[model samples]
Target: MATSVKSLSNKESKLIMAHMYVAFTALFVGATCGLLQTLERSGKFTLPAGIGYYQILTVHGVVLGLVLTTFFILGFMLAAQSKTTGGLNKTERTVAWIGFWLMLVGTLAAATMILLNEATVLFTFYAPLQAHVVFYLGLALVIVGTWFEGFVMFKRHARFRKENPGERTPLLSYMAVITMLMWQIASIGVAVTVLFQMVPWALGWVETIDVLLSRTLFWYFGHPLVYFWLLPAYMMWYAIMPKIIGGKIFSDSLARFTFILLLLFSIPVGFHHQLTEPGIDPFWKFIQVILTMVVVIPSMMTAFSMFATFEARGRELGAKGLFGWLKKMPWKDARFLAPFIGMLFFIPGGAGGIINASNQMNQVVHNTIWVTGHFHLTVASAVMLTFFGITYWLVPSITGRTFTKTMNKLGILQTILWTVGMLIMSTAMHWQGLLGGPRRSAYSEYVGNADTAAWGSYQIAQAVGGSILFLGMIVMIIIFVNLAFFAPKGKEEFPIAVVSNKAALPPKVFENWKLWIGVTLALILFAYTIPLIDIIQSAPPGAKGFKFW
Candidate 1:
């Protein structure tokens, strides 16, 4: 009954599938790297001397964190756009394809350099650990491609607004546009760093790079990068999950407000990541810490809204009692179950985030495995699981195929494996971190060092967990391949939740993009401009690039 009223055109279907294909391929490569890294850290496995730990780590982070997430989000947004609004017009579709090709070429270029060991610089790409010129160039192209896609989406939204003057923009399209807009703004910092700073330095045009300045620029993009991955998951949680469970969004207005808050607060809090670094005033760090805490409010609001929606749906199903409502949900459906489990992980993930944001508390966990555990919960568990859940139905919707009932069962098992694996690995990471186990180290270096021996058991646990996670990923990839290419052809449902009765129509002001964007820019300027100026003026002499590995 929740099936899309209109089917996607052949062109739209092809565009969506193309993006998804790249994303899944990257996921496979990234997950394999992840398992390898975990085993290496546990001392159970070792790469040949030329293939170093940092090299594999860099590949894992870039492929999964950057390439996979970016490609998947673009594809998912396009699919959402087609289902919610009419599919993109011919010109828009052509633009999207161009962007996809650019991204693909860029990804391959970057991956090649990293694989060749020319760019051992980690995903953070912090200088004086410089990457090859092509690595920077390739990454720049990917960002430009995303910008093109963002522009097209913005244009489509504008046309929609012109056509439907007084109506609230369709929720999915509105959210998608906002996500892209926020990313465009957020990425400017990284873009500047790469184009003007890293590229020239890598090409020998500049002999040295200001390490602190480069790191500052990267963090400016890095913190919001989490939200870039997150907001889409939020989109599914707020707009799609409720419908999958036969309910409505608790409040459309609140959802929009939450996104607005994220856009405003997300950029200014990058300093929270750099609290331990010098060249920035403690005052500015304190300011960013407060801003980071402020950003958590919107997540809390999301939690309340999600629970309220679930409760309302339960009541409608004639369920009574507090716990009984949970049972009424469609847990059998992978589309609902996986994302809901993701939401559950977000509770802990968000808590860890708040802890990391605290200026005082951060010192204890800074650069430790604790931070790794925190992010794995957020991005790997919360955001990634939600993406997997989306594909359970989305791939079928685009391909006009049915994900077989057996495949659905396997999907559930895959989610369980991932959840259990992440819990085991992340828990060990956090505990070992608190005990002073450093992150980003080759465990072989600690062999026979009594100081680090306590970490061995935890590392072993991580390896076991990583192995299970790898299997889970393999299962997911197989399920999707079957759904896309081998499954029986049939129409699949595309769920879009309705606004709840308790929620009134959002005010026109909520749709005032100019106001929100202006406020976001103002907040960023207020928070970052002065600190950046201070950093520039007081920066130490730049350092020459190094390739220690």
Candidate 2:
């Protein structure tokens, strides 16, 4: 029966292939737009206001970051976890395909309108400055498509639990589930916007929707969505690479804890995004501030747990010194080591991240390059680097083909170039932000007496940094494209693979929702407690005339 199931699984590889095709296009579009944005900012390429540069930017962020990636992750998780967490069958597969097509159509519809300049919401789609109704409708369809994929994941998890009643989940499968749960809970913001605002507006039902209310709604979805992009990247760090390096996980339970923490704390921390917005009460700010701090707990724990894992693994492998793990860790093992280095960068990134997510600090730095630096530190460092590594690392497994060693090394080198360059770039960006540089503008054409010349200096640095980032990205392109065209064909077997798709034990019906529920409760407790206190103290909106010791 297991062999038959295994044989049937080969049929599903096409789904992953389809997803890869879509993903590559999305990545291409996304990267291209990013390059354009960089060029426009440089003393290089400038787009006239009437030229719809912001339109392209919207398509870029939405297509690459949201649509393409969302569908790709959905497809990847659907296949990767199906057999491992519990095997999904043909019906679920069909559902996923339906989801994919819906999203594709939605993307095309929205992209067309955006290009035509009918949809100018600029990715965040802040309301009042309404986009074409089709834009909102298209977005709704995209989320609906995502919901299909989410539903399929739940169905598969259910089957796995029922069939395998007494075993623990495979690590990859476990993480997939955590991501799905996070998506389920975190998507409320966008979902609400579509239902209450976009749908009505699109159908000519409403004249104006409150932009702040919509932005808040999106944050409810948006902040956690950042983690959705991130967790998969981290999953690769925790699950796949260590095995390639011949190391045991330092702590599996802690990894689980990190996912749980992100699930609850991530979205609730969204109020920090609203620190600059109006109509929010002081109580809301206080609650957001506290949740922002609570967010640190899990990230810090992950830092400790992941570092401990690496150190233990390094030590066991005969690494030495106070931080010899840094030096002695296997840099040559492309799959194993690249992600380890990437995780090291996340430490400062996470700290800066917490500050960006803080009420007070974000007020000082929000909308500045500080904000840009924070995310570049994250997506460029964590998501893009790790995902590139995973492309090199996982493609062989997924394709059942042998990748060229030279190409693998090229990919690794690219990741390093990007990581190091981005570190410098984001650092400069963070500093400039501290110096009052604005972000998300076409250019710092207005420096407001803040050494506008320094803006020129930093822009030069960013230009250099952007070049480095592109070099790495080009290497990434070469490696993935090469693997797609030249990697050897035929199914490769997992070295010591499990025979079935069912995740071990605790079927969906019997599953414990309490763990995640408890996590949400804890997050709410930590997130809202201070806001509750603010209600009592009646703090003012400006945060003015208040000093903390």
Candidate 3:
């Protein structure tokens, strides 16, 4: 008898590839829109044939920020869970496919509206700036699809726990469950605003909408949406990065603890995003700001754990001095190098986040291009680069293809181009913001005002940087194509870190979903209940929708 290698079933592979295809398609289209936005913003190019600046901006933000991230994260979670928990059952697989199709249909509907220039509301889709009713309906469908996916994941994990009582849950699958739980809970805010508020108002069933309330509800989902993008990257960092670098996990219990902390802290801090808006009580804003700062502790814990993992592994290999271990890392491997660079970007990105969250400092940068630069550093660079790194091995593994050396070299070059481009673009945006450059507006001379005049050079620099980033994106798409179809037929490893023997086992409390969920709900209510009531009670009359596009 011949020994058999463990792998995802052919059915599972096809399901996973469906997601990959959609995600990469979104990447190409979104990146092209981004490049066009920068060129138009520079005042050097006009959007030909009535293609509006806000139109491309809307496509860029929605496609990349919402569509690509959601598809890739859910797909990656499914793959990880399947591998770690002995694969999804037939029902689970069927449910996953259903979810995928729903999301795809939703994406197509929304994209059609955008291309028709019927909805240029940007990614935030804030109120008083109404989109087509179909757009809101499409977005609702996307969220519903994600919920279905989350449901199956929860079911699969529950089945595994029942089948093998007393055994520790697999790390990747546990993390996936936690991520989906957070998603299920946090997404309710967006769904509520869309279903009840935006959809009704857009359909003209209501003459006016309460702008403040809609915005409040949105930021409720918006800030956590940041973490929704982040935790998956953290999963790769904590659970997968170690194996790529020839080491075991630093501490499984610590990883679980950090994730729990993220869950507890992520949802209630949206008020920090609303620091400038009036009507919310200052005391409540202050409270949320404190909570936001508290959330930083887990991030620092993650940073500490990463450093410890690297040091211990380096020491094991008999590296000499304090920094000698850095030399021991696999610098040439794109799988390791790409996400490692992402870690470096987060140092500045996280600092900028703290600045934005602070009640006092927020007054300095609020609504400025600095806010745009901050997220570009975060979601665009750190999270995006990490996702690309995951693709290096993941696409090949699912397709039963080898990650060849030529492709690896191309990936590293792509990472370098991305880093340089983002550095230039984000730096210029930050500096210009401090000089009072506005965000979300197209090129304007402001009647030759001196202040506006100062932003011109920076805009030019943005165009340059944006063009380079577009090139990098093309390179990434090429890598994706090779991995999916043309790479040699061989099995690539799905790297999952083993827990260190010296690490303590996680306490059962970590798995207590009810306890965590209860605390999360309490925090959200405590943070928002009073203020929400005040907003509703002492409200201005609602405003009618506007269509600037």
Candidate 4:
């Protein structure tokens, strides 16, 4: 049940591929920095050229975590919407281009500041650890660019609905609109903090900054930011993977419901990231912690949905017994395997998230390298692998090229290397963190402290893992290039699975944007308004900015 689809026109393909170019380039540069950081942390290597470890760390975080993810998500979503809705109209395409240029310019400006050592602030850009004004401005531009892209998606979807009166909205377009909506809402917190708080302070317009307020606002965006990354991966799992595996979607209604759940829950739960911050009230933190826990529902729902999708599909292919269905899966198809492994990683990743959200458990791992390991599993592994999976087919589809069997084999090799690398690196990180290893610092002896000394072996293990992951990155970049430029010209299908006829049609109520957006806002205001007021009124003396680099 392939939903037969036409290839995107060259203009639209070019628009999307622009994002791919930036994204893969960022992957190369960011992974290099990551490898260097791991080696430096192992204490067997020293950074040359007077490069600060924090500078490279900042680049690693911002480039991979922010720039690469943001660019790829936008590009992919644009393709999704375009594919589902016939194609982007002239106006929509122009708007997307405008968005891309803004983001590219913003990335360049911020990267320059970082390379010059003027901005060592990490991706979170926590306040009082200020960077150059240009860096903050650059980030703002990037966010604004995404907003433009979001607008284009919304407009295109609206046009889709208007033309096709009673047709159920295409699943991919519906999901894209929801994802962008979540992003637009969640990003407002960071946008507010940057424009009003950090921007002024960085320009010396303010003498002191409300450290607690800045932090509170940041986590407001910070927690949802993780979902902003995860939802796209979920999109692939729900809508695209079934087609690749030659199966019908398990349940369309369930998939939409899961995404709506993420939108409602993802925004209000940011306080889970701030559980240890003293200025926030314990009661508010408790409330938000419960909200964070609610997020597990959708995550589990997704897991359940994937399981059902797989089992049903496998049984269709004549699989027998409980575990036999797993064997029926397409193991050699990198298109399926990469994202399938990503789903597997999220099982532990989601469990780790639950642990991080718990007050008692958070007390153990707060600010430790364990938190770093946690996200590496979720975003870097689960989300990234899925993106790579999407790229394998997507690049060729958009470029009017065929994905050769040779490249398919290469993609499988890439997935294996990435899975092995991440398992080794993330495990070492979690273990070292449990032993009291701190995150975000270079090699240190701490006067030959025993606990710190115990972390040495783990650091070395991390270096080895990072080296392997870098190799995986190289393989991925090679595949991307060959698919985009060197592959033989032909039409490649953009796979979108048909809904199972046994499943009930999705309810129109799910299309009620007003109800859901209103609920989301109400939840956020209820969770944040009181705690935010408390922080501002009881605020301590604001701290001036610091440039550690």
- What TM-score does candidate 2 get on C-alpha atoms? 0.87
TM-score of each: 0.96, 0.87, 0.96, 0.96
How many steric clashes does model 4 contain?
0
Q: Which residue pairs show backbone clashes in model 2?
A: 83-501, 85-503, 86-501, 86-502, 87-501, 161-507
Candidate 2 local accuracy as lDDT? Answer: 0.69
Worst lDDT window (10 residues) for model 2?
Answer: 540-549
Error of 3 at 2 (Å): 17
**Candidate 3 off by > 4 Å:** 1-6, 444-454, 542-549
lDDT, model 2, position 104? 83
Quote model 1's TM-score: 0.96
lDDT score of model 4? 0.90
For candidate 1, write residues 1-549 as lDDT tens digits. 333322577788889899999999999999999998999988877776667999999999999999999999999998887677777888999899889988998999999999999998988988789899999999998998998888878888888889888878888898888899889998998888898888888888768776777788889899999999999999999999998998999999999889888888888889999988977889988888898899889999999999989999999999899877898999888888899999999999999999899988888889888998998999999999999999998888778888779989999999999999999999988987776678776653443233565567788999999999999999999998998888777787877888988898887887788999999899888888888778777765554222211
| CA RMSD of each candidate after superposition | 3.2, 6.5, 3.0, 3.3
Best by lDDT: 4
RMSD of 3: 3.0
Instruction: Order the numbered candidates by lDDT, best leading.
Output: 4, 3, 1, 2
